[model samples]
Each structure stands twice: as structure tokens, then as C-alpha cells.
Target: MPLSEFGDAWPGGVPVQAHGMDADPFFAGEGDLGFARQVVESAERGELFLYPGDQHYFADPTLPSYDPDAATLLLSRTPAFLGVVS
Candidate 1:
């Protein structure tokens, strides 16, 4: 559902979103990214990570689009963002 639809029903807590710059059109396009940005901007706490030159499934090891660098960075940042590690 669109973020606007959530209205006051939006979930609480910090949101962490990671997306590739070249995300698949079927999954997400420029409009989706713009909407994501709006979500983060409207939220009290949120994080948006955009990996340039990467595509959808960039963090999936089994996928050909897997990007070791971006995936590694994502893995590391995720735990940190969740306060799971220092």
C-alpha cells in the first residue's frame, strides 16, 4: 500500500531501507524510489541506502546481480542499524 494510505496507521520504530540504483522496473522504478524517499523524509526516524550501479537482488548471493561490495556493506550496516553490533 502507498505510504499516504498508512496515514496515522504507519508503523512505529526506525525504518531501514536498502535499494539499488538500478532496481528492476518490475520491482521498483524511479517513482518507487521517490516514494521511498518521501517515506523516510516523513518518518521521525528512517534510513535509506542507495547503492549506485547495483540492481535488484544485489544482496542475494545466489543471484547473478549479487554485488559483493554492496551486499557486504548492507550486511554490516543492517546489524549496526538495528543496534545488534557496535
Candidate 2:
């Protein structure tokens, strides 16, 4: 769905967590950062945003693009996010 749909569906607000890397090849050619910024800007009251910066930071450990520290940080923070959203 489009980002506008998200804005329309949950007028109250929603917690959002976005993870991306500046050097990620997949996003390099696209406007991912711009889109993400829009989402963060449009976020409702109390919403959240999270982005880990590294080339393909969220990739699995088996992937060369994976960043251990970033992944660990994301893992540690995830539980808190779940709590907040819940």
C-alpha cells in the first residue's frame, strides 16, 4: 500500500521503525531515504523511527553486507519497540 494509505487508515498514529543504510546498493538508485523521511515527517503523535546505517545493515549474518553491531543494536531495541506499540 502507498504511504498515504497508512496516514488515512490510522489517523490516531502508529509507531514506525525503519532500517536502512546509506550505502545500500538496492536503495542507492531509489528514493528510499526521501520516502522514509516523508513517513517520519507524517508520523502521528508518539510514533517512532529507527534506522541503522551500514551497507545492507539488516541483512542476515551469512550475508557480506551484514553489520554485527547494527544488528545487535536492532535486536536489543526491538523488544522495547514491541512494548511501545503494544
Best by lDDT: 1
What are the per-model C-alpha RMSD values against the true structure? 2.6, 4.0
Candidate 2 C-alpha lDDT tens digits along 6-52: 55433445666666666566554376665666665566633333444
Highest-TM-score candidate:
1
Clashing residue pairs in all predictions, respectively, total 0, 0
Alpha-carbon shift of residue 37 in model 2 (angstroms): 0.8
List candidate 2 segments past 4 Å from native.
1-11, 45-54, 84-86
| 10 residues in a row with least lDDT, candidate 2 | 45-54
RMSD of 1: 2.6
- Candidate 1 global lDDT: 0.69
Question: Cα deviation of 54 in candidate 2 (Å)?
Answer: 4.8
Q: In model 2, how large is the Cα lDDT of residue 44?
A: 62
- Candidate 2 structure lDDT: 0.61
**What is the C-alpha RMSD, rounded to one decimal, of candidate 2?**
4.0
